[model samples]
Target: MSKPGKLIQELNRMVNEQFATPEFHHFLTLPLNRDRARFFVTQSAHYIKNRRDSWGYVQGAAPLDVKAIIWKHEEDELVNDPRCNSDHYTLTVKTGESLGLKREEIDGSEPFPAGRAAFYAWLHLAKDRPWLEAFAASAILERRNNGKIVRGGSLSDRIGKKWVAELGFKWDEMPDMKIHRDADEAHSDLMEMIFNRHVKSASDEDAALRGARESLEIDRAFRGALADAMEKIS
Candidate 1:
């Protein structure tokens, strides 16, 4: 029976390994030509929308205090933020415009099969698992995006930099990713607080780790599917 702090540290290390997975690296480093960029940005919108669905399940299953925390988190994601002036989905479409994508194109885009499977997996955990396990599963995604947790930088921060350096887009032009770079740090901390308060037993810790690890595996598959899609774009 490890302490909660040690349990969280182990979870963090496990989730960080997702970034080092070959599939994740392959997707992140994929060349961002116009076609690929359009595909990426469009699929990103699908991913963001899936987050809304999955989080709704988590919010429903969570304890009242944790639900309150998630509600505030959703205020920024589902509603307007001071930094973005719109919800995250709209912000993603706005970012796509900088890549020469129209609102219609992004709105009409469908998620690849692997991405859909990943979303369903997340929703299953959020809706069917115990509250702590479900919450940890959902929160681990944001935690993995916390550059402070990950050694180099978060997924959003790293990808945002790549867009700036390789795709010739300015940071300001990609408001969604830019905001996530900062926002997920706080989001991750909030989740940790939940874990500290709730995860008291060895079984609870094991459940949390199981949910987080499974989600990361789905994440890798989703990223790999995206990379394969990008390669096929002509």
Candidate 2:
């Protein structure tokens, strides 16, 4: 059940390469900070917020079935998943309270310019492209986050470890990194299955490749911004 014109294999290759790039390291470095792990945690929250916005745009243009799959994925993101009892944003805020950051700080800090631009660019791509292609961009973003799929560890897991070891955070108490490390595993696998099933013809495949490439380009920049902001904040 692939698309009218899909190229899942090539897109998969491109997306796989994107996962191995240096951008993810740059993005997650903030969480490695001993003095400012909380800032990184908050910044990560912003990153996930951007992800939600991009996913929504993709959902708006995807096929009904794809939309449904993405909607289920959003259950772990926008809505509550029974496994966690909270959405991704709420999870971040919970981490904030633990770090002694005020809720106003979590909810009120506007996204940095770079993060904002990268997000809107992704949203534009998601909104304007063909459904599979658009959906591919958002999927590619998760694939980047799915450290399990990425080879080392997901950014969530690395950040989680950093919060405890490098930052001297309470090893047992960091919920944001703890929960996502497990949840994104399931999310990424589900997305991989979705891609395998839906991408059919060459044209559709090309669109998927386009989505992966464009999103990766922006993601590199997005992650770079996250790292930069973390450094400055620290």
Candidate 3:
């Protein structure tokens, strides 16, 4: 009835699982008062920093066309996307100041060592794997975040809700995150299309599926580690 994908069936199964859990949403919804919110925002900075590093390395190994796509993606991330006047990382740090995070506080000592290692390990996979697989790994993270794909709710929606209920900040108060909340949906969709379109053969599909699976597995650990650290943060 339809074209069979080398990996889409399995990849879709794995991708759906990422959303089927309340774990990610729980991390955001857990009642963190102002002091905890302060820590949560600070910790979020560290996680975004790791995201930048992994994405940069993934772009480094992507095919020319996919690289161009990611380059545009990074324009919002590392460079200016015109959508945002500055990089998202800078936008995030500035957003951090709202919750009382100074640059030094964010950059200051005390990050989760295990989380840090996992970030580097993701980069290694992006750098070492074939272009499709590498790109698939990075793409799945956003796919996991995309509300349209993963179900339950997006990471951004959950985070935004928690902020509203806890901190009393309107959506306009954190403009950058609000934009990413929507834009990442398009990004993840574009990436999944790439995976689907290019898998002309079984092996290509297998590689892409492998990349998606491995990335999702690592992400579960990474999120768990971050949640643990946030829970323990004094």
Candidate 4:
């Protein structure tokens, strides 16, 4: 049974390791034409919405203090983020618009079958698991996006670079990606605080690790599925 600090290190290591997995490698390495890029952006809006839904469930299941923190986190994602002067979802739509996607196109898009399954899986974790586990499940995603933790510039940073190099868009043009690159870092720090406070025993660490592991597996499948779908587009 590892100490909580050691467990946190292990979890951060696990997230960094995900970038080396076949699913992430394949998804990130795939070529991006305008059509493929547009497809990805549209699909990403669905992913963003799923985050909102999953977080709502987590908030409901968490302790009151944790719930308050989660609510504050939601303000940036669901209500209004002062940094972008828009909610995260609206920022996603604007990002798609930069890629020539219509608002209706993004709004009407559905997650791929695997993405749908992943969303439901996360919802289950957030809604049905113990509060610590549920909170870890949702927090792990933000941890994966935290550049300080992920070491390889985080998911959005890597993907945004692809857009700049492959699609010829400047960094400033992708407001959502830019904002999340910073936002998730702060969010993950908040999550870490919770683990520091609550993950006292091996049992606590185990539950949180279970949730994080399952969430990452689902994330890998969802990214792979997105790549497979994009490959078929054109």
The number of the candidate with the highest lDDT is 4
Provide TM-scores for the models.
Answer: 0.96, 0.85, 0.86, 0.97
Q: Looking at candidate 1, what is the lDDT of residue 88?
A: 83
> What is candidate 4's local distance difference test score?
0.89
| TM-score attained by model 2 | 0.85
Better of 1 and 2 by lDDT: 1
Top-scoring candidate (TM-score): 4
lDDT of each: 0.86, 0.72, 0.72, 0.89
TM-score ranking, high to low: 4, 1, 3, 2
lDDT of 4 by residue, 135-197 (tens): 888999999999988887999999999999999998877889999999999999987788877
Global Cα RMSD, each model:
1.4, 3.1, 2.5, 1.3
Worst 10 residues of 1 by lDDT: 1-10
lDDT of 2: 0.72
Q: Once model 1 is optimally superposed onto the true structure by TM-score, how far is the C-alpha of residue 208 displaced, in angstroms?
A: 0.5
TM-score of 4: 0.97
Tens digit of per-residue lDDT, candidate 2, span 1-234: 435223444544555576456886566554455435566666667778878877888788777887888889887788887877888788778787877887788887777788778878988888888777788777776665676556667666766776777757674467777787777767767556766677556776677778878988998887777777777764
Error of 2 at 151 (Å): 1.4
Q: Model 4: clashing residue pairs?
A: none
Q: Show model 2 residue runs off by greater than 4 Å.
A: 1-16, 19-22, 27-35
